[model samples]
Target: MKKRFDIYKEHYKALISLGLPIVIGQIGVIVLGFADTLMIGHHSTAELGAASFVNNVFTLAIIFSTGFSYGLTPIVGAMYGTKLYTFAGQALRNSLVANTLVALLLTVCMGILYWNIENLGQPEELLPLIKPYYLVLLASLVFVMLFNGFKQFTDGITDTKTAMWILLNGNVMNIIGNYILIYGKFGFPELGLLGAGISTLFSRVAMVVVFVIIFLRSIRFRRYKVGFFRLGLSRTVFGRLNGLGWPVAFQMGMETASFSLSAIMIGWLGTIALASHQVMLAISQLTFMMYYGMGAAVAVRVSNFSGQHDTLNVRRSAFAGFHLMVALGVVLSSIVFLLRDYLGGWFTESPEVATTVTSLIFPFLVYQFGDGLQIAFANALRGISDVKLMMLIAFIAYFVISLPTGYFCGFIMDWGVQGVWMAFPFGLTSAGLMLFARFNYMTKNR
Candidate 1:
């Protein structure tokens, strides 16, 4: 029993060591989102609602691009584990190219959405706010992707602190910019929603630039930089990246689509519903990003272990990460539940929006276990490069089960926005179970 306890303790420490920096970085991002929502909500509930709709639309593309960039992590992690520094650097270079392509594709897709924005059943009064905000966000996608490539590369090398510091610093700049531009507090034009968008764009651009400078000048990355400049892109590298990237991208895209599409459905209900959804989503991101931060550690550890052919450690790391995420879910859900009433008011003055946010908290709590489970196991699978199956599972879970259930509950059964939220637990839990089973089977057989 003592030995078992020691093993579990070691696992916990390892996961936390890797995950803490990532969690801190993710918290910074969540804080930025909160600041954006709160500022916009206070300015105008209509602008808040518009931000919700526009953000939800772009979130799908952003998540997809992020997933695509994640293809680099496991590859780089494995190479780093094998002490193949040059190979890892080459992979990172290829990832940059691939991510840039993905950014362009996402931009085109967003452009299409922008052209058809008026027909999405959103409030007409908010179009002016949504249009400029969407455009600025769309323009920032390439920079976001660039930052992701650098971040994943560093994370794979187990140097997570660099990205963490950069993200936190960028977030501080973003919040300060939001204050100055959103309200014209510092001789800046009161740009309102557009100001928030501009702040985000500036922050993203700065992050990428800083990352590049660090990669070039920092001695920590000197070895990787040496190889990075010497290597040329290879077709094999591109193909491998695409093979892993596309499946993960589509899986995440489908999952995000479930929420994004639901946002559209909520928009059909009214501005109040959309505004409430925005506030709730901003809160929920706190939980999701925490889980994802730990999940990313699991991927990094599992990939490293897999490269060393240490199946036991790979499985142990994945489960350990899940355990941490479960704990996080408990704490986050408790806080959100206990403060549901006050939490909503932090973002908006509307009693109706507050009440709606309060109503959505139950569904948010219901899906926490499922969300943590799926995130952990999904990263586990990614570590082993078992991505093709994830695409099918995501489609079944999000598209076949979740979306239909939400539509049925929200529209057909007249349960409204809360009902749509209810469908998340079913879909997320199903996906989690499927992914867990797959990971178990893979690890056991190996």
Candidate 2:
């Protein structure tokens, strides 16, 4: 017992050492989300609903892009583990190209969606607000992908603090920008939701620029400079990245679709539901992004171990990540539950929105376990390059199970938005369990 306990403790320490910076950075993102929700929610309920729809649509793109960027992590991690500095640097170059292409693809797809925004069944009055904001966000897609590429590279190399610092500062700048523009501070015109969109676009661009400059100029990256500049894009490398990236992207894209699509259903219930859903999503990020941070660490560590053929450590690290995620879900859910009443009020003064937010709390809390579970194992699978299955698992959990459940619950059961939210736990837990089973089987002997 003592020996086993000591072993687990060691894994915990290592995982936390790597994960803490990422978690802090993710918390910064959550803080920014809270600010966005608060600012937009108070600007006007109509704009809030518009922002909700637009943001939900863009989130699907962002999440899919992020997942595609994750393909870079394992590749870089493996190279970093092998001490192939030049190759890792070369891989980063390829990743940038791949990420950019993905960005353009997403941008075009979103652009098409923009062309038909009115057909989506959202309230007609929101079209004016959604259009410009959607355009602004669409323009930022490439920057978002570029940032994700750089971030995944840094994290894979275990330079987690650099991206963490960059992300934190960028988010702070975004909040300040949001304040100045959203409310028309310092003699600026109050553009409302458009202001928020402009601020977000500015922040994302700044982050990418800062990340690139740092990567290019810093002495810390001197080791990578030669390869970064000298390595031309390789067909082999590009193919590998795309092959790996698509599966992960589809996996994550489907997971996000479950929520983004649900936003549509929530929108059908009216603006109050949309506003409440937006705020609750912000609150949900407190745990989701934090778990993602740790899950990312798991990927890095597991990839590193896989590179070294240290199967034991890879297995240990993945399970350790799951344990940590479970612990986090427990702590965060408790805090959220305790503060349920006031949490909604923090976003908006609308009594209806606040009440709706409060009601969604139960489903929000229930999904934490599954959310954490899926994040840990999904990243673990990425580490092992066992990702094609993830796409199918996501489809089953989200499309086959989650979406229909939400529709049935929200409409047939008349559970409204809460019923929609209730479908999450079912989907997430199923995905988690399947992912866990896969990881367990894959590493069972090896």
Evaluate all candidate structures by whole-model CA lDDT and list the values in order: 0.93, 0.92
Candidate 1: tens digits of C-alpha lDDT, residues 1-446 = 87866777888898899889999999999999999999999999999999999899889988999999999988999999999998888888999998998899889988998999889888899898899999999999999999999999999999999999999999999999999999999678999999999999999999999999999899888778766888879788889889988998998899999999999999999999999999989999999999989999999999999899999999988888898899999998998888977988999999999999989999999999999999999999999888999999999999999999999999999999999999999999999999999999999967
lDDT of 2 at 213: 90
Where does candidate 2 stray beyond 4 Å?
none
Q: Number of clashes in model 1?
A: 0
Native-vs-model 1 lDDT? Answer: 0.93
**What is the clash count for each candidate, in the order shown?**
0, 0
Error of 1 at 70 (Å): 0.4
TM-score for each predicted model, relative to the true structure: 0.99, 0.99
